[model samples]
Target chain A: MNSEQQNATLRKMAQLMRDGLKTQTEPFPETEKEFAAILEELRRLDPGDLEGKMVISGFVDHPYGPDRQRCMECMYYLVHRQWCDLPELAVPVEADWWCRLWRI
Target chain B: MANLLWLQGGACSGNTMSFLNAEEPSACDLVTDFGINVLWHPSLGLELGENLQKMLLALTSGQMPLDIFVFEGTVVNAPNGTGEWNRFAGRPMRDWVTDLCKVANFVVAVGDCATWGGIPATAPNPTESEGLQFLKRDHGGYLGKDFKSKAGLPVINIPGCPAHPDWITQIVVAVATGRGGELSLDEFQRPKTFFTSFTQTGCTRNMHFAYKVSATEFGQRKGCLFYDLGCRGPMTHSPCNRILWNRQSSKTRAGMPCMGCTEPEFPFFDLAPGTVFKTQTVMGVPKDMPTGVDKTGYIKLTAAAKAASPRWAEEDIFVV
Candidate 1:
């Protein structure tokens, strides 16, 4: 996508997080089985269902927990693109943003 | 000439297939160049019926010198330890293995099945199968822990789902050529030359690994398979990258995860559903760290590496 379109999407996602749209960010999957379950849940949603994906994945604008982990340290995060690279959740994200899909 | 006897039990013959495909010192080279006498190999032997039994009896009775005894599959001790499941020539193959192990100058166990009981020995183990010298990490197996060949060496294990062809031939040549004394074995009895290096050594993904960039999918040439995929390259001790398969490429080199086939605990996680090809993590951190790395050091290194990763490191590059 063009820079403008990408920026617009990023802004929309940031606004959604700022508005406290309670995402399911707890019980971060502890194993591949649990991780796969989350992926399965995400797969059940319509591809256009951005809100549903966000809620299930537990997205937040700030760092999380005692370790202060965030998208910056996540394996799926693309540093230069400032985006989540997971095929299921291809969305623009802030470096410091936290998500349940986060993995080192 | 070294008289080598090969036998199989509860096996898929994968190692034999690999042996036939040997290139560096091919199967033909073993006979012509290496001076190895083909006493009897399942795939290459010319004996039939009574002749095969005669050859086996001669070896057992000290008429035919058995220089090397290479077993390629699990020694099945099923049916109340009667060895009825897998029969060879005339009697149970397990019995033949027992008799052969006693008289052979050197004993070699090839592939996962013959070395660590492999899939046949997986939980339940209905076949009552066991390796020559080990059942997974445990020491004693079909043979007692103290059991040593006439040459005084325990079973020299060359393990893999299908051991690399060259490893099989090279080790055979070493033993047949009277260099067995020079060969050193690790705890698992694998020759140190082949098992000392990790699979990650010489891996093309080393840059991506050092940078902590994760390869999210198969065939993505850019990142390392460790962080996201279920690659056991870092933890597995095998020269896959060094002695490339087909003399050209390794699993990691071709964008596939190292399945840890060379390690004793292969089919790791007990072949559980959704475990293969998927990295197992706990609280977002990997459960099995690289061989020598601790949790704290791993995390610190990851942070630094990810921060320092160059943009070029994220691009797919064909590895030779």
Candidate 2:
């Protein structure tokens, strides 16, 4: 997507989180198999189902744990693009935002 | 001339294919230039039946000098330790290996199989396969831990899935040229010269590795494979990047993760599901850290690197 399109999507996602979208933020995937299962769930979603993607992936607006794990430290995060680069969860995200699919 | 005898056990002859492709000091150069006498090789040997048996007998009985005995596969002792499962030249190959190793000046374990029982010795090993001097990380494989060649050195292991072509030939040349005593070996008995460096030492993607930008998929050309793709280059001890496979590229250079084939615990996690290409993590942190790095340091490094990563690191800078 172009810079304009990405910004619009980013704004929409930010607004949804701000409006208190109840995403699955508990039972964070602790292993690759669990993480893979979540990716499999994301794969079965409609391409445009952004809300479903956020819900299943356990997206949280703020850093989630004692270590405060977030998108900035995730291996799949593209820092400059403000995006999650994971193939299953390719979506715009703030650096402070997090999801269960996060890995360093 | 140095008499070199190459034998196969529970193997696929992949090492023989690799040895034939050696270029730095080609296989032909061993005979033509380095004065290595090819007594017999499974692929190159002309002798068959009684002739091969007679030659093997001569070497074992001390009638002929066996300068270098090169082994290419795991020593199989199956169906209750008789080694009949992998018979060769009228007897079990392991029997021949035992006899030849006792008299040979230098014994070289050529590939991962012979060095540390490669795939054949993995869990539920029906063949009861084992390496010359090691089984996985443990000492004492088919040969006892204290076993040594006539030269008083343990098996000089040149390990890889099919050890790099030059690694096999060059070490052969070293032993053939009577410089075998000068060779230093690691705890695993691999030549220190080749196994001292990590595969990540000279990698082109090192910049991306430093920036903590992971390549999420194969052949991505932009990021390092370590963080997401189960690359063992950081912990693997091999000069893969320095020596360069086929004189051009390595596994990581081609965007395939280094499988850590040279290390003893190869086929790591015993080929467990979802473990091959996917980095194993615990609580979202890498299960195996880079050599000498702890979890806290890795986590801190990742955060700093991600923040400091230049814009170009996230882009495909390798424009074709």
Candidate 3:
């Protein structure tokens, strides 16, 4: 998909979370093993399953937890492109949005 | 002529191999150009059995002047501290080390084993091995903290898995040419000249590092290895980038992470499961920030660096 398609999918993800989509957000991965487990889960899902990717990754439209971490500060975030550069979760995202995979 | 004796104990003979690959002021240059009389070396020496023992005895007895003593492994005190596990010319290698170190004008510990016990001295050290002057971060190993050579200097540690060839040959030339006293050493006894810089000093991926782009996979041709991959270049002290291995490229340059082999705590985390190539994180932040950086500053820097990152920073811009 092109950049425009990716942006549309990201917007739909935000809408899903806003419309009371209960996602697994608690028990943040505190170790590499935990982090990798989450990635493994995302990897096992169908590549076309954008909603499953968002739900499983615990997408939030704003900064997260006590640290107020966001995609803007994430190592995998591309600021200019407004995209998540993770190979497993290739989706455009807003600067303020966050997910369980969020890492600085 | 300056007499140099090279020996090994509890080692894999890695440093000896690295020494043979020296090219800058080559190994042959040490004898031909630098006027160094190679008294004996584990690989290059011509003596055998009793002949080798006599040479070692001569140096210990002060009958033959010992200019430089180069040890390239650990001092094993295993099998009830008898040191019999690693026997040398006549007795336990440790005994020979004790005698040789006393008379030599300069004592040089080549490679990590001789410098900081390396892998053999890792936790549950079965061989009870130790470096000449240090066991990991501890100051005193087989030698006491106050121990110094005849020249009044502590054991000069040239640390690395095997240490770069030039690092070994260059230091040897300096010592053989009466410049040994001028050489300054860091707290780890590594030459300050080479140990002062980080392995990341000349890394080609600095742009990716500055932009906070993570190189998720190996040999990606772009992105920094410090983020997703466990690269110790920013914290590791070495001239790997500046000196260039094989006179061409370093590990970082060739898309490999700096293993931080030169550091005393190398094979970091005792080769823990899941710690090798993966960056350790806590609460979504790196467990170990670059050398002196704290978490708060890192977050702010990432936010800014990420925001300021150009279009090229996110893509593989290295052209063929």
Best by lDDT: 2
| TM-score of each candidate structure, all chains considered together | 0.98, 0.99, 0.96
C-alpha lDDT (0 to 100) for residue B295 of candidate 1: 88
DockQ of each: 0.73, 0.89, 0.77
After TM-score superposition, what is the CA distance of residue A3 in candidate 3 from its true location, in Å? 2.5
Error of 2 at B293 (Å): 0.5
Report the C-alpha lDDT of model 1 over B148-181, residue by residue, as the tens digit.
9999999999999899999999999999999998
lDDT tens per residue, model 3, A1-104: 78778778877887887888877787789898888999999999999888888888888888988878889999888887888888889888898988888888
Question: What C-alpha lDDT values do all the predictions have?
Answer: 0.90, 0.93, 0.91
> What TM-score should be assigned to candidate 1?
0.98
lDDT of 3 by residue, B150-248 (tens): 998999999999899999999999998999999999999899999999999999999999989989788797799999889989899999999998899
lDDT of candidate 2 over B73-161, digit per residue (tens): 99999979999999999999999999999999999999999999999999988899999999999999999999999999999999999
Q: Is candidate 1 or candidate 2 better by DockQ?
A: 2
lDDT of 1 at A102: 90
Interface DockQ of candidate 2? 0.89
Question: Where does candidate 2 chain B have its weakest 10-residue lDDT segment?
Answer: B213-222
Between candidates 1 and 2, name the one with more favorable lDDT. 2
TM-score of chain B of each: 0.98, 0.99, 0.98
Error of 1 at B61 (Å): 0.9
Per-structure clash totals for the candidates: 0, 0, 0
